[model samples]
Target: MSVQDYTSRLSDPASRKMGTFSYLPEMTKDQIRKQVEWVVKHGWNPAIEHTEPQFAMSNYWYMWKLPMFGEIDVDAIIAELDACHAANPGNHVRFVGYNNFTQSQGANMVVYRGIPV
Candidate 1:
């Protein structure tokens, strides 16, 4: 079956408890910056990941690039996010805040969603 067909048959929920403010509406740019700042202040590294539209419902996602640890600059992070979005305009992009103390646990938030044509 085509990936689109498989995706169409999936029944994922509209909302997921992924990030700190995920229970609320999708955050604005300012809000996102605040969250990123908080994460950086707490010594967490930020990372970006995305999945193409065809695999939006899949558990697997491709990393946009390496994690941005030790980089407290929010603009740089946002720039990377924008770059990723520009590169994959038809994909679902998300931000991940990785905590070293957690070993393998991290907070995730969807940052950009490309509308299907």
Candidate 2:
């Protein structure tokens, strides 16, 4: 086949195009809890963000609020995600782990996929 066809075969346009965990299947609530738990175990601060599906691959996303400092409860984090999703039902919701020491992102994954507007 042609190079364009070969490349297209290797890439899935249907997949979620977020920063991390994009290659994996859509994460369930339990999986999200596990990921948040890992973030807490690593002492990484948690944050939430959202964006329109069309902007999912964009570099910038609207932060739900300030990065949650010293957040240890996974349920609270999930609740914040829920709140953001409730407010922006038409936007994709994601959870992120921020490393204060590194001043960079540790991990991020899309937890909820929004309906296309």
Candidate 3:
């Protein structure tokens, strides 16, 4: 499915569901591994840690934060951000692509939530 479809699906309140990354790119592997490792080491149950992987999750630098966690499929990650944008259409959505000239492939789609009240 296209990112738009994923984004649309994310808005359905019922669509907030669990999911995982199909694969982590070499550049992101270490960080992703650490997040997973935290779950394993602290004995945090997967069911509890990654409460909602399917949609509207944030792409925090370190990963593993609740109501949402894990690396997630890039497609799914982008979709979640898109969903957030959809929910607040008037607000301009911006992003810092994975790798800027100076950055090390830290590409991500970050959607700052909400419109001005």
By lDDT, who's the top model here?
A: 2
> What lDDT tens digits, residue by residue, belong to model 3 across residues 4-117?
333424456443322323122222534544543443344332211111232235542323223223333444434544554565454433232222234332323223322222
Order by lDDT, highest first = 2, 1, 3
Better of 1 and 2 by TM-score: 2
Global lDDT of each candidate: 0.75, 0.83, 0.35
| TM-scores of all candidate predictions against the true structure | 0.76, 0.81, 0.25
Estimate candidate 3's RMSD in Å.
14.4
Q: What's the number of clashes in each of the models? A: 0, 0, 1
Q: Which stretches of candidate 2 lie over 4 Å from their true place?
A: 1-16
Look at candidate 1 and give me any clashing residue pairs: none
TM-score for candidate 3, please give it.
Answer: 0.25
How high a TM-score does candidate 2 get?
A: 0.81
Model 3: weakest 10-residue lDDT segment is: 46-55
What tens-digit string does per-residue lDDT give for candidate 1 at 1-117? 654222222344333234455456778999888877877888888999988655656568899878886889989988998899999888778888898897654678778875533
> After superposition, which runs of candidate 3 have C-alpha atoms over 4 Å from their true positions?
1-67, 94-117
